[model samples]
Target: MRFKLQTDYALRALVYMAAKQGENCTTDEIAGYFQISAAHLGRVIRRLQNHGYVKAIRGRRGGVRLDRDPESVNLGEVVEVLEEGAQPLDPPTGEPGNGVDDALRLKAVLRRAHGLFVNYLNKVTLAELVAEGLPEPQPAQQPSEESAPAEPQPTVAAEPEVASSPEKTPEPVGAPSAAPGYGRPGSPTYGGY
Candidate 1:
């Protein structure tokens, strides 16, 4: 359920690039802005480049840019490209006849749920996330003295206690006084003492 730091960095770098639009941004610039290591950023950029998410240029004015429009890129696709062997859950492993078969069935169900989640993500693009503009919160309205009073809260019902069987009763502490052979016929204390 957790993403690696590299994936997180890659997403941040992509967002920065998307924000810049047509401008070319250098790894050093991104590292400086995010306070990350330049060497780490360089590696992240290379991975993005290999995944066709970014295009790198070489020269004095050269840097990295998004290969495609932000609207055309899905967040899930970006995650897949940036993450290696990244999955929502681990695959099940076990022998056929063992109880592992049941575990594998449960894993399959979980995998299906994960697939649905990924499908939802695939439907949303980065542009959608960026398109949401910030709005100011509205102030709360004051209640008038003439307004009706709120209704009282309802009381919760108590649960009934269940009685236990005689066999389940616990013995009294320090109440027993019996020797190993006290009840035996041949013992020193045969019946009563």
Candidate 2:
């Protein structure tokens, strides 16, 4: 099934933003990038901004940024928002005889098909879709002591590499845990990772 042109442009913008880093995107930039009309794209940007997907900054060099993480933005929800009143078939409205029952059955089949389509789309996140083309390469992260052990310790019975069983090394102490209510509500870091 085909989406409206507006939805297509919005998806393109979303994917482009997902592939970018740091700098916000300008409507002119998006228009230039896609070779679409700036005015038409302006409307699309406004619609996306209204839906909490993009946020516009006001200034001379101002531009829009992806407000929510790509993974959190569901494709089905995006389609739903963009295609609110544009269903493929009219729903089953109760009416007697004359192939109306057939219409109802077709509508039911369409609904099931749509359900399956949306479920499949929901399973595939935007992050997964854009992973192959992330704008910049991120630095490799160092594994933390809290997350994993420093090194593998060979057992005494399986003496393959080591001559003797070495003494266990102590794990480095981690930062102190936040005290009760220390990082609770009213903190700047609240709701942050």
Model 2 C-alpha lDDT versus the unseen true structure = 0.66
Tell me the TM-score of each prediction against the true structure.
Answer: 0.60, 0.63
In model 1, the worst 10-residue window by lDDT is 133-142
| Sliding window of 10 residues with minimal summed lDDT for model 2 | 134-143
Candidate 2, after superposition: displacement of residue 107 in Å? 1.0
Clashing pairs in 1: none
Candidate 1 residue 186 C-alpha distance from true site, Å: 82
Report each candidate's C-alpha RMSD, comma-separated, in the order given.
27.7, 15.6
Q: What C-alpha lDDT does candidate 1 achieve relative to the native structure?
A: 0.65
lDDT of 1 by residue, 68-116 (tens): 7889988678766656546655665677868778877787887788677
Can you write out model 2's per-residue Cα lDDT over 1-193, one digit (the tens) per residue?
Answer: 4566687667667767776753688988876776666787789889999999998988987899888888898777887899784666966566569788899888888878888877776775556546644222112222243367548654443333443568554333342233322123333222111
